[model samples]
Target: EPEVTQTPSHQVTQMGQEVILRCVPISNHLYFYWYRQILGQKVEFLVSFYNNEISEKSEIFDDQFSVERPDGSNFTLKIRSTKLEDSAMYFCASGDTSGTSTDTQYFGPGTRLTVL
Candidate 1:
């Protein structure tokens, strides 16, 4: 079975630096998403991308953040400037949104971003 994959399993940076988290979802999946979990907080949806454009986004996804599918196989989330509050485990997920009761998303291992 295919699964989502992310790069830079762990990242350590100082405040105000830029970071790009990358992911590759299952080849046939049509929906891609980014979510994050602060150390002791719940996982929150950040954004969803489809058809090469943003389909939905949460309040957490502001001007400082952006996502792109640079090619057919790679999806990436870029933070223009990192903040201490941005430190968290970022997850990448994908699923087929075609009407199906069994629609389930497969998540990547996650990229842990730590800010100092």
Candidate 2:
């Protein structure tokens, strides 16, 4: 079965530097989302995109963050300036297209971003 894939698996960056996290969502999926968990914190939604535009975004998705579908198969999230608090496990997820209320999201293993 096809699955979402995220690259690097881990990233280390200096504060104020930019970082781009990559993901390839499952084919035939209609919705994509980005969520982050700050170590022991709960997973918080960052943004959700569908039909080529942002469907929803949380307060955490501030001026420093942006997302795009750079190609038919690749989705990317860019952080304009990293901060020490920005370190977290960023997860890329895809929604099921089966039209079921229980259509759960499938998550990538995650890319652990570490800012110094």
Candidate 3:
């Protein structure tokens, strides 16, 4: 019955500002990931983290974006410099710790980021 928790339900930032969104996923999950959906656009994968390091990343996860698990219980996504195009709903997700890729990913409600 556990689920992901994201802080600052919504964020408003000016272009070029830095933003960090936080999340706390299901306790027993081992893999974490970040995804985003631009308003009216398709959802896109940003990055995947496991064992405290990045396991995989998509082209959208460029130098401008980064993720970390500063504390075992919290997962965070940081956008070094916000862009208008970066405005989107960012979701946090986690998968089972079964050590198999087949496990399903459970997603958080998401943090809506708005950029001017």
Best by lDDT: 3
RMSD (Å) per prediction: 1.5, 1.4, 0.8
Q: Candidate 1's residue-wise lDDT over 1-116, tens digit each?
A: 78899999999999999999999999998889999999988999999888889988999999999999999999999999999999999999998867244668889999999989
lDDT of 3 by residue, 1-116 (tens): 89999988999999999999999989988899999998888889999999989999999999999999998799999999999999999999999997587979999999999999
Give the residue spans of candidate 3 off by over 4 A.
none
What does the lDDT read for residue 66 in candidate 1? 99
Provide the global lDDT of candidate 1 against the true structure.
Answer: 0.93
Best candidate according to TM-score? 3
TM-score of each: 0.94, 0.94, 0.97
Between candidates 1 and 3, the one scoring higher on TM-score is: 3
lDDT of each: 0.93, 0.93, 0.94
**Candidate 2: tens digits of C-alpha lDDT, residues 1-116:** 99999997999999999999999999988788899999999999999888789988999999999999988888899999999999999999998776355768999989999999
lDDT agreement of model 2 with the native: 0.93
List the candidate numbers ranked by TM-score, top first: 3, 1, 2
Task: Judge candidate 3 against the unseen true structure and give its global Cα lDDT, from 0 to 1.
Answer: 0.94
